[model samples]
Target: MSQPDTLGYLVPQFPGQTHIFFWREIAALEAMGVTPVLFSTRRPPAGLIAHDWSEAAMARTTYLGEVSLRRAARVLPRLPWGALLREAGRDGIAVLKDVLVCAAAGEALRDHCARQGISHVHVHSCGRAALIAAFARHLGGPGYSLTLHGPLSDYGPGQRYKWRHARFATVITRKLIAEMQAELPKDLPPMILRPMGVDTDYLRRDTPYRPVQPGEALRVFACGRLNVVKGHQDLIEAVRQLRAAGHDVTLEIAGQDDDGGGGFRLVLEQLIKQHRLQDHVRLLGAIDAASVKARLLEAHVFALASWHEPLGVAYMEAIACGVPTIGTAAGGVPELIDDGVEGLLVPPKAPEALAAALLRIAEDPALAQRLSTTGRARIERDYSARLGAEVIVSEMRKALG
Candidate 1:
């Protein structure tokens, strides 16, 4: 089958601070001669929209959270009551409530897709947005696909119902695929292993990466949301250990807390104060892609000690920019970085181990050069945004056929 002229791209809380990969994927789809109609459950919080493209993205997106009562009433009779009841029986009351809400949004989505001539949608979330797409399918709106970005548990209830109706699903890691196979039904939709990727072309460094000299401060860059599960506190402890060991090091973390920098940022600040890392560690507070790339280029090493990351695009961006990265050996990180080859991997929440890894990279220029060269090469070869886009389009073609 030939490619459709338009495709629907659905994301929950679209254009959030950590949604750069979705933006890159949309651009990739456009480059392949496919127009992506952006759909979101709702707009993200104003402060959490940090990217320069947030305004333009918001201007173009169609939000489905605002359900018209007239439309809901019109489509109410069309809902598959039998199937919904079965879903409730399998999942319970809470999921049924969410499904009902998404059913309303599905009615609106059907109307919008009819007006825009969108035949297929790819949901980038397995959360409520996936439920919206599923109900849209039930309403005869569009054939929908799903991308499982993390563990199914993190996406919330009704896992079986969400996967039952998808044309196909793309999981970020083989580990996640295994978990899905174990938890979900055997008669499930086709599952593809397509890890999230960064735009290597855009994330590449123009200038040469400079290693930390003997006297200069070892600039370390970490990027992720300021949450406890993200292990920012552990990274801070590592920075303190590196300083205590008499290595000149400075760390800059480029992300904000969920509460628009008020919630977990205060907690991280208190920890930094306890360690007396006020001068050595700075929270950059949710920087833009250009700023992150700039910092990656300037830093000697990049590190993020996530407690359990699905797959880290920040690590990809850093590696794509030729900065030797250090990620904890948790979740799908080992799939991205080899232990001692492309980048370093330390145990999660082990501040001493993280400190040792950082010190090794700072002390050894040869190891840093090898990791920098090989890490960028790895991204260019297997983890480019273009490659992921191609796989998605290919899968969409097969499904539509």
Candidate 2:
């Protein structure tokens, strides 16, 4: 296990905000003299490669849609057809479709890795990409590993098979490790905790922890997709409650509509109007990384009442920038921020609890400042992009061995 020379990095999207953690990890790996080849299942939206870092990544990245069938055919003859067919058949039509696409992608990836001399593949999600990575490994290309970001419910039955086949796997929280261990077979690969994080330096604010002045409206900031799991609707309802209670509060939500075909955004918009929070809540759709940091700096409180967040990097960014953050005690959030230590944790999908938490922070500046100071220190002490990268690279070495 003398260090792996070349590794393949597989992701669903290449340069989107959701993949920012992967960008940081790739940068860290490059700093340590490892070669990484980026592979995306599809091309990102127009102009996503806006920043210098993303632009640079676009050069080394390969969009799997551009994969040629002629090249993929090289590995098809070597594939274990019986096992592959059985695996595909066990799943329904939906999974069979994924398997067909994944098998083709695997064949293409195998051919690409052979030419590049890549010995390992690391997929970012436990979804289709991981399935493709497992398929590629089964095609006798290279060792593979996976990182689980979303809830396990999102993954299909094939996920268990992928976990068993991966060389090693890492979940963003220890709770996920326990869940997977209990559900998966004993022969599954080693599962470890490697939490998602932010580059604190990138999110550094010139004036961290800005106290709200008298008569100034409190800037309540929340960032994430305008979808259900993020609980944006719940946050909006809480803000509505806060406004009703005679608190001068305005919430700025910064994220795109991740739901297909603008459905969820419409729902959120209707909720805002129904609650008459049109003036109180501003939907700033899809702000960049710089804008996110800027909003965090100008805010008195950062909150995301997500129902099931695996490990929110937005909370890390806000906490790193000294914003008194609040998150739901759902899915690895408590692992990142304590109830009263680093930040406040409220029950998920409870608009009343969310409003209470926001009200508490707004009324008590001392509590807000205390949480801000402690949260910043926690980010500095426990979370960093470099630290996460080092852990992942070390695990890759173990897998290589």
Candidate 3:
């Protein structure tokens, strides 16, 4: 088959703080001679748009949430109301309202694709973005696919309705495939295991890996959203434990809370002050990708204690940068990092175990060196953003066929 000339890329909020992987994949696809028309449910909050590419990305994106009375009047008359009502009836009242709102966006999506000559769309979300695409197809728009980044429960309701009309779906982990199969119907579309990836070429370490020498201050780095489920507080406690044990440790967490910088960051700050770790811990709010890479290179260890991560691109970035990474063995993380091979793993919410893992890497230079070497190798081997883009392109072709 000939290569697709144009493809529609849908994300909930395009170019958010943690969406560097999507940007990387879009670049890879562009390099493969495919033009990706960007689509999003809405623009993210001003603070969440932290990437350097945000301006260019926003300029090219079509936001469905920018609904105007004129556009709605023009599109609503052509919607597949009967089909949408029938589907929503099977779910409940909540889904009925959701489908109604998304169906309008769907009509707008259809018109956008028609104008751009795009025949297929790939949604990087399983939430309402999936619904918008599905509704667009019902209105005789483009065929669509979905990429499930986390558990289905986290995305919201109406799972069956969302997956019913998709051409195919890509999941980030094998465990999620099993969960999807068990929850969704058997008559669903083809499911592919395509993990999220990073740009290894850019994330590569420029200098040699330097293990922390004896009695040197241990610099630990973590990157993730400031959420309770992310377990940033637990990581802070681990730093406190390391300090109490006469080990000099400094932790720099690079991320902002969902509500700009005011929400969970305050809680974490209180914890830091309560423990009197005012000087030891620093919260770096929502650094850019280059800044994150620079921090990873400067740090002796990279760690994020997510209670349940589907698969972590932050961990991938750190490992690719040759930082000895530590992650909780909660979700798809174990698939990315072997317990004792590429990096270290500990149970979630266990500050003591987290402290032990940090100490082990801090005390043993050999273990840190081994993890750093093998971890970078692991990312280079199976988790480059280019590889992920190839899988997506192949799947899109298959779906088009």
Candidate 4:
């Protein structure tokens, strides 16, 4: 029987504001009378235990060592056949490194569980946590499972690799589940029926703010990492077009670039200068979650032009805050927003369509109000954190059944 009192929740790190999914879900599981033991590379918060693996920074952000290790694993299969064997032989050494990582991680977790009288382990992402969980289980640790989010878990061979590990899988959308299921055998365990959730408590704010005026500055807000797939470029251009047409629209982009990533930030900067949008745009990097929420609370409308949104929590939060959304119809967006309801969906990479939706929302107050009321209620009914946690615990129950 699975242990009900203590659940070890694993994350590669514990500091990302975007991935509060992992941390907040832990909070959810904890409220279910299950102790959540969070395993991370960074030192845990007070009264919470953490294990450190290695310190590597991307964009000055310290992440776990497993990230680089996973990248090296990807490179190993591409070497010359002779070199491949050499690496394969050294794979034992690599395994030894993993052994150390898992030993530290598992001991921290297992010891915490033993003292607290805990039983099961659950990892938030399938990448490093999958390996750690498998290793921990091999070490005779707690029965474990993993929850998968982000493209790293779904894109390319990593998904296939991670598939070999998780006991019971959880994804945020139907598309992600289908993609994973199609890639694997039929007899694999059923994917959990849980999606990303919104903490209605934060979004349940009764604060009302006035929107941007058409004759005045039409302030547009966009948030997310400045990456290609996020479609921030398209958003900037759309804002430029509106401004060029005598609409004084100012675009405020609040996020960090992927830091040595695709140099998408340079591309965006060039686009902004070429369009002469010096006054029309503001780029704010990496604000705290409460600030993001505050921004949402004060904004006229919220928009995310991502080309790969598989159930973005941002939309749920914006909708819950009564900020109508204009999102790309890519990925799980269509599943979340109903046209003329909670929000509107536009085709990805299409500035004109996004601009049209923006214009509609900006012009019609009655439509926006109806959407806010209905959307907020939808959050309360369907996407509450408590509801999401209950769903997770139920998934565990079914697996144990």
The candidate that wins on lDDT is 3
| Residue 27 lDDT (model 2) | 79
Candidate 2, residue 268: the lDDT equals 88
lDDT of 3 by residue, 1-401 (tens): 23266899999988799999999999999998888899999998998888889999999999997776576566666766675566567666667667656767888898899888889999999899998998788788899999999999888766776788888888899999999888775647899888998998899988888989887999999999999999999999999998998999999999999899989999999999999999999999988888998899999999999999999999999999999999999999999999889999999999999999999998889999999999999899989898877877888887777
- What value does the lDDT take at residue 341 in candidate 2? 84
lDDT ranking of the models: 3, 1, 2, 4
Q: Model 4 lDDT vs. the true structure?
A: 0.64
Output the number of the TM-score-best candidate: 1
What number of clashing residue pairs does each candidate have, in the order they appear? 0, 0, 0, 0
Model 2, range 1-401, lDDT digits (tens) per residue?
22365778888878775567788888788887888788978767753343346777777788775766675565456666665566567665566667656767887777788878888888888888887777777877787888888677687656656777888877888888888777665647887788887887787767657667778888899988777989999999888888888888899998876543266878888999999888889887766677787788889999999999988998998899999999999988999999998899999989999999988887788998899889988998788888877777788887777
Error of 1 at 358 (Å): 0.5
Q: Tell me each candidate's TM-score.
A: 0.97, 0.92, 0.96, 0.79
Under the 3 Å rule for N, CA and C atoms, how many clashes does model 1 have? Answer: 0
Assess candidate 3 and give its TM-score to the true structure: 0.96
How accurate locally, in lDDT, is each candidate? 0.88, 0.80, 0.89, 0.64
Residue 131 Cα positional deviation in candidate 1, in Å, after optimal superposition: 0.7
Cα lDDT for residue 133, model 4?
A: 59
Pairs of colliding residues, candidate 3: none
Candidate 4 error regions (>4 Å): 1-3, 41-117, 150-165, 208-214, 260-263, 397-401
